[model samples]
Target: MAGPWITEHEVSVVEDAMRNGWYEHAYDYCEKFQAEFAVYHDRQYGLMTPNCTTAIHLLLAGLGVGPGDEVILPECTWIASGAGVTYQGATPVFADIDPNHWCIDPESVEKLISPKTKAMIVVDLFGNMPDMDALQAVADKHGIFLIEDSAEALGSVYKGTRAGKFGIGSVFSFHRTKTLTCGEGGMLLLDDKELYERCSMLRDHGRRPGGPAYFNEEVTFKYMPFNVQAALAYAQFQRIDELVGKKQEQLNQYREKLSDIDDLQLNPEPEGGINGAWISAVVFGKSHNMSKHKAIEELEKLDIPARPFFYPLSSLPAYGEMIDEYKTRNSIAYDISERGINLPGAANLTGEQIDKVCDGIHRILT
Candidate 1:
């Protein structure tokens, strides 16, 4: 039942959009939101999309990734990260994640690259990041594009660079559960002008930009965000620090509560990096005999909400034809996923709730 923390600010802008956003002013909020969001990520351009999945589809299409092409991404991610590649008629090559960071492993990515590989989709999973420098080096060596799926790492930083600033293009989600939400929305951030312009065109059915009204030059997908959603997102964006800070605080509370649990590994804070703390997760040690299912069962009995960490993408039935040796190839992904559990990370989650959850974990493990 956790929800976004909203105030009169979001209500006011949404009302403004509903009342005055029309015709000539229809895109006012969208444009403003897009620009400011991109700048926040230190990118030169931003294109709003209906959702993160649509944004991924748009990025794949804009990059001309199609049949016969392949995209490498960590197996430990949401389905959208892999499903989007299939929409482009491209094959998704699943790689193992770094056990410590829970993001795409650069070494695994390097081993997966091939002549068919056109891009690498590095997901910042659960607000955690891998070694971006090593991944970037691999991409550069192979002459492939680095596309960041930063849907969960909005405020995460690595070596002083924002999560969305590492790749040729990055996509972020503003879903209801995210730190910054507009009910349902996403954005594409990038520094390349040509790719941005091309994606912009693709976002609106490939209408020739400024050539003519209703003139379509090529056939493509339309993933533009509506003004009302932009208004809500923009309102949330205005309080970005507040939203992100609350998540960090929530994570701190979890760390304090679970600090004594030696059998658990909480989200990491690497040197020179700041974890966005989107969803606080804990992975029980293999020797602890506490699987994700068992942990969730115990928490549910105590009326505590919990979620399982993502399953290995290759193990899903939808991807069975693509990779069959998921257990062997992605041992770390499969291993951690079984023991990892996503704790309640709602901005409004109370300390008492966190204490109760941590107590449940301690009781189960001890």
Candidate 2:
């Protein structure tokens, strides 16, 4: 992956972190970023974590979802989504995705909800929000939490509302690959102070902050993010709008450059939402002579990096037990996973670079 986009501010804060001491008690860069980020998403609380996966784990733990309970999630997400559920010893029931947006289908999510279901993990994959209105309605009817795994969607929006605000809580990844990068960090966004406090305590060894001296309330994971990482996040967060706009420019470039390629199709923009412009992905026509793997290999040979979409949960060995269970139920996810190709859409990429990448694809196919 490419390095994170950083300005002089990140460098200065990191230098100050070293001089002032990262272990200093009064240090507040991390907290500052957390507060700013929370406001950016219109949430009341935000807690930074070491990574998105651990954030999910802590969120699930805080919500009291564990053994014998179930969390419904789309079958075509990064493995970390399922890993989070497994961490709680809860079953991750797979749901099909809408073929157009490649996000969890609300109807499929409703079908998967059982008495044992505790929540629905809706992933805004590729920076697109699923039909949150519909998904939230199902969650309300079932009295289950709607947890948005918005790891790939930081600045996206749906029907005028921010992407992370639709669900009761949302998680964002600040990994280098994301539009906003801190090199490595994650944030949990929510309006519920009780759940926020619960997750905050769970994030840092079950200790509740009592003035400067904290108390150990219960047993929990030690998954706190470093102030150093948050400093980087602060720097990147400042340029979030520019970063998102740059990628949107790249998205437009890719759409224009590859419009004539009948066998290669770009993902659809959300009907009433904005994309975070994470990665410009395409789904190759099934009749193409070049397989997805072959296409990736070809792109590699031309010095253009490309990646296949995540393998559907039904096909992964890690979820073999659930594979058979989800095989018939998640056909759309399976089909989309096999065909989707994630093209590079980094902000620093230039128009020439995008054209070169698209040209490489055209040459490989022709």
Give the best candidate by TM-score.
Answer: 1
Task: Report the lDDT tens digits of candidate 2 across residue range 1-366.
Answer: 134566787799777765674555333777888899989989999888888888888889889989999999998889887688898899988899998888999999998889999999999988877888899999999999999998988778888888777677888888877888877788888899899988888887778866246667788899887877787788788888887887677777888988988866675677777887677788888777666688899889999988888788768788775666776788888777877788987666777888899899888878
Q: Which stretches of candidate 1 lie over 4 Å from their true place?
A: 321-324
In candidate 2, which residue ranges exceed 4 Å CA deviation? 21-26, 211-214, 321-323
TM-score against truth, every candidate: 0.98, 0.95
Per-candidate local distance difference test: 0.89, 0.83
Q: Over the stretch 1-366, how does candidate 1's per-residue lDDT look in tens digits?
A: 346999999999999999999999999999999999999988999999999989988889999999999999998899988777999899998899888988989999999989999999999988998899999999999999999999999799999998899889999999999999998999988798899889989988888556689898788887879999999999999999899898888888888888987767888986999999888899998889889999999888988889999988887888874445667888889899999999888777887877888888887787
Candidate 2 residue 25 C-alpha distance from true site, Å: 5.5
